[model samples]
Target chain A: MATNLTGKTIVITGATSGIGLATAEELTRRGAHVIGVGRSVGRCRAAEERLAALNPAARPAFCTADLALQSEVRRLAGEIRGLLAARGPAALDGLVNNAGTFTYWLALTTEGFETQWAVNYLAPFLLTHELLPLLAAAPTARIVTVSSESHAHTSLRWADIQLRRRYNGLLAYQQTKLADILFTAELNRRLRGQAPHVHAFAADPGLVDTPIGQKGTPELVQWVWQRRRDAGIPPAKAAQGIIALLDEGLAPRPDTVYWRHGQPRQPSRQAQDAAAAQRLWALSEQMCGTNNGSLS
Target chain B: MKSYVLITGATGGLGKAFAVECASRGWPLYLTDLRPEPLELLAGALHRTYGVPVRWRACDLTDAGQRTALCEALRSEQARFGGLINVAGGDHEGLFCEQTSAQLRSIVRLNIEATIEMTHALLRLRDASETFRIVNVASLAAFYPMPYKATYAASKRFLLDFSLALRQELAGQGVTVTALCPAGLPTTPACIAAIEAQGVMGQLTTQNTGAAAAGTLDAALAGKAVYIPGLLNRLLRALGGLVPPTVVAWFIGRRWGAARRDLGNPAESSILVPEASPA
Candidate 1:
């Protein structure tokens, strides 16, 4: 775990707290220069200050971006590209698509799409695609997406992807998780064996206690807290799995699915469905407005 | 020549249940699994009970080469394949990092690799104008990352997605691919172990394996991409997803981790594993 990240520049979305913040601290401690992305400037500044205090002034910088909005995510992507261009080629070592929000109530993003799906799926989709050049500029770059096991329940409804007809927050979140795996699989398929080196890996940080769960209510959040406290494994250990994927070169099959505990997890039914992958790819191209090829 | 439904993992708990459901319907059977003795015994019993011809193929499905050879042999036998159900699989109990490479590889090969190969082989044999069915048994664990049974869940998720996509691609091609997502069935060893592992062995009786299989087959034939076996599962599947990944992952990971530890407690085993006769 003691590897030098000294000159390495890392980008992480959702850096305000929980896994994102914890990862920021860990990466900064390991000598990497991290650019923390969060929605609130105050929280971002606070996190940056905390990191500085922990690192004794050797802290990664902070960038404020609301990943829920495509425009904002696009801007963040550009900013990252600019930073890397200035830092020189292969300066960017890793990108963590960790920023996401889930609402018990159905909400819409600035893009007019469902909030959870847009923030969790669409935003990452766009940001990753837009900054691909910067990712490619680097000799070997790693893109670690945080997905979930909840994705098993999600069925891709091509006809009504937004859940406009029948909206359920949980189902929508699962849809996005399923999308994460599909996107990862497609990305790996496109990478064709060149991963972490040429953009490889995505991980699901199996349940850990984090502030993101408290968005609903204090009581609800406490319930979440107690459940996690009762059943929760250490987030640090789960984070180790993400670190493992980044450090230990991904297996021969990056397109193959894995869980945060460093176990090989099955992807959602949709991830393996080639026909659905094809359909989803076409739809995602339309949604993200990019032309990456199909997984078939 | 009578048409036959070939099933893998046909000797175990869920597989045996599926076999009974199919046999009762007068479907000729072609069953395979690693446990040759029990599989053969089940095959003989089913044949005698139903008066339907039964053929048992013994092979480790995780071995791709052996699975290929088995498929070729089945094709050579000119078996009129009507449907193929992939029900054979097992789980490794341990922390993800502690899991041996062989354990992870074996589960992946059996659940994902073997199923994929078997589906392709049988799809190749289906008559152009005749509708054929392929049922890939997946689990509710696939719905999300399992902190405990991580790899097994991910494999099921892959199958769930693969089955749906294949179903769509094969649309109008006379081949239907349906993935069955069953949660907490008490009929098999794996199910019992999973239930015991979760500290909710009593809640394991949500649906019988035979009923779940019939429901899954019905959904597959009707062209539904995925068939979640129970109402409660469908609801939980619908709920508990509104929060962010890190949040849900944290909650689930913690809960499952604790449950895994509980399941590991030898005293809890009595409450977890149900003693049952093979249906």
Candidate 2:
């Protein structure tokens, strides 16, 4: 049966480019009303135009917010919640927590957390928690987080959580990706028992030639991948993998990792580790400046 | 209205199983492999048993020219390939140091390069009208780094990552890409020998070709981007939390190292351990 995406409202972060933009386009084309969250007004406007061009019948709303900043991420959630609340209960269908940062150089967000962990993991953590009411309003809501293959190598450092002691851009990225996996796993665990209507999933784009990889003045990894574009899969295909999980009929599996090719790859061991996931969840709550009660 | 299915690595044990299963499903077949005799026999057996159309091509997928030629042949035959099962891939059982430049190139060429080329070609030909599906045979080794099978693990990692990205990119395009990551499937002679030699026959589950392919195909259609063939594999994959890859690699390498010694090759020798990410 064809998925009934009509009348479904989906909010996608990082919808300005690559997988996020492609997913927005695909979802709109499938007849869903998309509300795009991008950092820049210009980029958001451009995305709005693209959405209009792709599916003129589906006029997607655009909101500008720097996802790396907690205040902005919070405001975006409030704005989305307000928008959905205005439309009555069960207005939104999904939220694609796709916006993320890959800092090549060691940097910290204004919140004092590592930039990658803050943007890729914590922002979504706080944003989703804050918008739980709006998500719950919907009959069936899906939260899709775009993670990375780098997570396979990540080992969560409890003492030096931010990698402040010893830092490498790739390593930090991997840790955050691991955090995303752990976050999704815990999210699903909580959702399965408490919120059956809400389903959580994680998707990775593989080794796409994205700007996130072209970090630190493009000298580091550009040559490695530029030489291998033909070998690497495209971003458009990766977006489809994310959407498959959002499909209405997609089976609800906790701790599932969706690959770009539409199959559920096994997540890194940390993702499926319930004890680790719980610890990570607790840590994430602390990092996001939220109390344990918020998620509970 | 005949439906045609494509199988790469049709000569291998697992690939042959997919061929047999698809033929049993009453689909006409387009099979490719490096060896001619096995490919011919697999096709003949399928044709004789299922009474379905079967086309066999012996082409080294590592060679781009040969892969392209095979794809062109399938296209020219007016075969609207419904599904593509990339089964033609294997590991060179050696340490990273033992792998010659040529051997490393062959591993990359056969496992990663062939998969990317074939999938890209099929993606170009696919549309919503066709029930398009892609199944890339990756290894659980793709999950993490293995000291013994470094290149093979990296290649599988590349496939797993690519499969995740491609699945999302092709959504609504009506094509599904599946990466099958299985560990220690005692389907072939090589696998059985390796299991016994390692005494991991206790730890490993010997899944035959038919069962593995069935699981692969079923998961692929269900839009599963990565499918580990067995329940134990799935459980271990989820164990990523408690264990780290470094630790797993250390333990696995030690065990395989001992096994290699029993095989008359000491710890100094090469062992092809398919990398499974720490879980």
Candidate 1, residue B271: how far the Cα is off, in Å: 60
Write one digit per residue (lDDT tens) for candidate 1, span B1-279.
147888997766567666766775688888987767766656765665456788988988878888988988998988778888998776665566766787778878888898989888887776545578788888776667666666777888799889878888888877888887777665544444445455433343255454576677668668777888767778777775565656766677786666656656332121212112110
Q: Each candidate's chain B TM-score?
A: 0.87, 0.89
Which regions of candidate 1 deviate over 4 angstroms? Answer: A1-6, A56-59, A193-196, A217-230, A248-255, A292-296, B1-279
Score each candidate by Cα lDDT. 0.69, 0.73
The lowest-lDDT stretch of 10 consecutive residues in candidate 2 chain A is A104-113
C-alpha positional error of residue B133 in candidate 1 after TM-score superposition, expressed in Å: 46
Model 2 residue A289 lDDT score: 54
Per-model TM-score of chain A alone?
0.87, 0.92
Q: What are the candidates' interface root-mean-square deviations?
A: 23.0, 26.2
Q: How high is the TM-score of chain B in model 1?
A: 0.87
Model 2 C-alpha lDDT per residue in residues B238-271, reported as the tens digit of each score? 8853788889788768867776666555333232
Q: Show where candidate 2 strays beyond 4 Å.
A: A225-230, A252-260, B1-279
DockQ of 1: 0.01
- Model 2, residue B162: distance off in Å is 58
